[model samples]
Target: MNHNEIGIEALNQGEIEKAAEAFTKAIEESPKDPVPYINFANLLSSINEYERALNFFQKAIELDDTAAAAYYGAGNVYTLKEDFMKAKDFFEKALKTGMENSDLFYMLGHTLMKLEQPKLAMPYLQRAIELNEDDNEARFQFGMCLANEHLLQEAVNIFTEVVKRDPQHADAFYNLGVAYAYLENKDEALEMLGKAVEVQPDHLLALHAQKLIQEAK
Candidate 1:
């Protein structure tokens, strides 16, 4: 098997050392190819070796400026480091290079949300949901973006879908409650907040919201 494939197999099998050895050999054999470097970078990133992963991603990008995987890897490293601006830049670059993946859209949307640019985040989050409708996290984030944009009904719809798909999603329930409250549906809000606290007893926000709604009643 090719060194890269062997390296991938080793990584998947959780043989870190063997995977590293195979990836190193793959890089040595194909220094000009960006794929091995990108794969190694991803492996390093997965293991929390951020600096090394960034270096490998940079090397891959230097080898092939159009390498979308390199840009995406670099974006992930920056995101893990909480450098949201840098993450957004690299993610945008990846998109500019025609890298279209649910993860790419999700990360870019999440980065925008982190930057408090919810208006800009909406389309990317929507794209992520479109690409993977079952991604509850993406749907939750999309709901948040919609709420931030003052589209309470839309936010409620997304959050409802999230909670329906994953009943144990306390955060989704909490947000759904909040959206309902904003829409002046006090009964539904109380019900959802109660469900949120039931699902996660220590969900402080949900508890607090439920108490306030009860007091209001």
Candidate 2:
């Protein structure tokens, strides 16, 4: 069988490296096929080889102007590099090409946050949370974004949801303590900060919160 067919079979079998090898051979066999390039880009990104992944993403885009994933993948790489503006631009391009992953919304939130446009990030972050409430990372970020925007009450809600979803997440607990402190609920702040310390013994922020509370006493 041709390498392209082998690649498809291997990918179907969840043998990613074998699939990548097969696609590499397919790229050699049919240099014009964008599929091999896309496959290569996906695999490289999975392995965190951003530079090589970006090269293949560009190749896929060159071969297929209509490929949304090419732009999305590139956006992801730029996001990893902290190039929020570039990432946002690429994400927008991908959306124009019909990308609709909730992750795209999450990325938009991230990009906007880095741009210090926390208010602008809210809608996208809210959309992401609505799409995937179980996405604790997005929820945590959303809470932080809200807190930064002076929407302390809303921030409290988001962080509360995060702690509810994963009680073991001490950072969320720590941040929740901060949110409560902002609200001037000293008792709740102390309690949550204590919970954070209980969950993560070495949590500096929790310890600091405890110290601050003690100093206030």
Tell how far residue 172 is off in model 2, in angstroms: 1.6
Q: Each model's TM-score? A: 0.98, 0.87
- Give the alpha carbon lDDT tens digit for every residue of 1-217 in model 2: 8787787688778788898989989899889888788878877777689999899999999999889888988898898878889999998898798878689889988898999998888888888888887788889889988899888888888888898999998988898889888889989999999999999999998999889987996
Off by over 4 Å in 1: none
Deviation in angstroms for 91 in model 2?
1.5
Lowest-scoring 10 consecutive residues by lDDT in candidate 1?
129-138
Distance (Å) between predicted and true CA of 141, model 1? 0.5
Highest-TM-score candidate = 1
Question: How does model 2 score by TM-score?
Answer: 0.87
RMSD of 1: 0.8
